[model samples]
Target: MISYNIFTLTNGLRVIHIPNNSDVAYCGFAVDAGTRDESENQEGMAHFVEHMIFKGTEKRHAWHILNRMERVGGELNAYTNKEETVVYSSFLKEDFERAAELLTDIVFHSTFPQQEIEKEVEVILDEIQSYKDDPSELIFDDFEELLFPSHPLGKNILGKPELLRKFKSNNAKEFTSKLYRTTNMIFFVQGNIDIKKVKRVIGKLTNDIPLLPTYKIRCKPLPYLPIKKILSKETHQAHIMIGSRGYDAYNDKRTGLYLLNNMLGGPGMNSRLNVSLREKRGLVYNVEANLTSYTDTGVFCIYFGCDIHDIDRCISITEKELKKLRDNKLSSSQLDAAKKQIIGQIGVASDNFENNALDISKSFLHYNKVEQPESIFKRIELLNSETLLDVANEMFSEDYLSTLIYK
Candidate 1:
């Protein structure tokens, strides 16, 4: 069992403290803004800003910011996804205060220098080119593009290099000022932390933060439409991704779908798809299924890479598994084993301190409360075969699936 304390500052910052006996501390902030918030013109600003913030800040130069943690045998990093941007770090418990102050500095006081912007733009352009060169990496974005036509959600997180060149330091400042609000952010820490001390240190760091009111530009919810396209690419193996929009994170049906996805093609080699496709016949080098859930929407997907000639046969096997899931219910023993497998998997994942903090922060950002891992297990326990069958049949139907292939 994990124990955590939740508090909100007067400036509207939500902080979560999970005390542990370990000497290393993991801490970070999650801003409820990302590529989804970017306007068409601002395609990559959210991600760009994430990189820029670390380059320099008002109180610290880029050197100081990078070395602040490393000097103490620590690490600092951040990432941007479609819906959130996170800045996090790991350090010895003794450097907790230093880590906290350094994080606060970068988040609130970044100075996006012109020189840094020019250099970073080149780096980003190279990134875009590299991403384009890898069909395995590029097809996921292409599949989403096919599914969501003319929508912000469909745009690549890494905007085109031409548009990225137009970004200046002022653009970074304006974008951060608009979206990085106290009300729109949460802080999470897991380590040998003193809750009161953390509150005081972070309180002092956030003292300068104005109680900025929140803003959200709600994108019109996208309607799911299945479209299939095959692209001829210069590649060693044919890559395919098939999927459709799925249940939102808040949907009651998601728990069943979660379990259903795990039973179908989750990470473990024992998954149904692996058993049916890889172990049984040895058709592909890699095959897996995944589901990405957002606040108001979600995506259910399966991805695989195989020989060009084997593409049709592998897809047929995949469809057969889907049909079995859609048309029939798992037997009593199979259902029990699936439940145990997913429950144990969730339990093991919760042991990851960094993932726990990040996940809890997002949960609070979305639900206004943290749903304990135990709560998830209970929900999974209540999921009967009937419930799973309903989810598989509805979410896995052939009509909603979209396929993208690179050959």
Candidate 2:
């Protein structure tokens, strides 16, 4: 079992410390600001601002910041998602203080130099082009575009190149100042250190975050209506993705969906979709399903790539497999197999302490507490075939799923 302690700063930055026997520590800030927080005028601003954050800070130049942990053979990295921005690092256990101080500097005090912002805009624009060049990957974004047609949730994180080019330093500063509040952040660390010491370090590092009068409030958008779209592309193979809006992270149905998705098409080779679509019929080379849950909504999708000539047959077979899950209740033996398989998969994945820290931080952000592995397994075991079929009935209903195809 993983044990952790929590601490809060005077302003509101929550800190989590998980002690481990490992020599390397994983620590950083998990900011609550992301793409969905951007306004219409700032389509790509969240992601753009994420890139500029490392450009420079009030105390440390970009180069110095880059080498702060690297000099000690550690790494500093960050990423932007639809709902959060994470700047984290993996460093030697003794360098925990150094890592915390540097991360605090970047997240709270980035100076966003003018020249750096300008250059990064061109780089991000290039990124947008690279994504468009791959139809299989691009189709997922296009699918969400159709699903959440008028909402920020639908906007690609790599915003429009034209809009990105016009973003100035102050623009990023304004977004950061308004959204990156002490009240909206979490400091999570895992290492071979005393819990009290970790708390003290985080408290001191975040002692200066300003206390804003109001919190950033993002209203949940209306649920998406199902829609199908076709994009004609000059590509070597046809790609298809179909899915419906799924239960949010907070919903009870989410656990069932997690198991159902894996049985249908998870990382393992024996997944129903992989076995039926590739092993037996040999319709396509790549086929998989993914489930993503956010604070207020989720997107579940199945993507497959095949020769254009085999597209119709693939879709037919895919629907047949989904129909089995939706209409047929699993036998007791089948349910037990799936439950044990997923439990083992989760167990194997939990061995990575770095990923464990990241997941724990995100869980705290959402549920305000981290659930132990045993509790999670209990919930998974309690779910019956009826629960899974019920979820499949809703998530796999033809009326709810949308299709986006690139051919």
lDDT of all the models against the reference? 0.88, 0.88
Q: Against the true structure, what is each candidate's TM-score?
A: 0.98, 0.98
lDDT of 1 by residue, 52-154 (tens): 9988998778888899999889999899988999999999998888988989889989999888889998988898999999888898888878877888778
- Residue pairs with backbone atoms closer than 3 Å in model 1 (clashes): none
How displaced is residue 274 in candidate 1, in Å? 0.8
For model 2, which pairs clash? none
Q: Residue-wise lDDT of candidate 2 within 145-245, one digit each (tens)?
A: 78778788889999997788788989999999888887777889998988877877887887777666435777786867888887889789999998988
Q: What TM-score would candidate 1 get against the native?
A: 0.98
How big is the positional error of residue 123 in model 1, measured in Å on the Cα after superposition?
Answer: 1.5
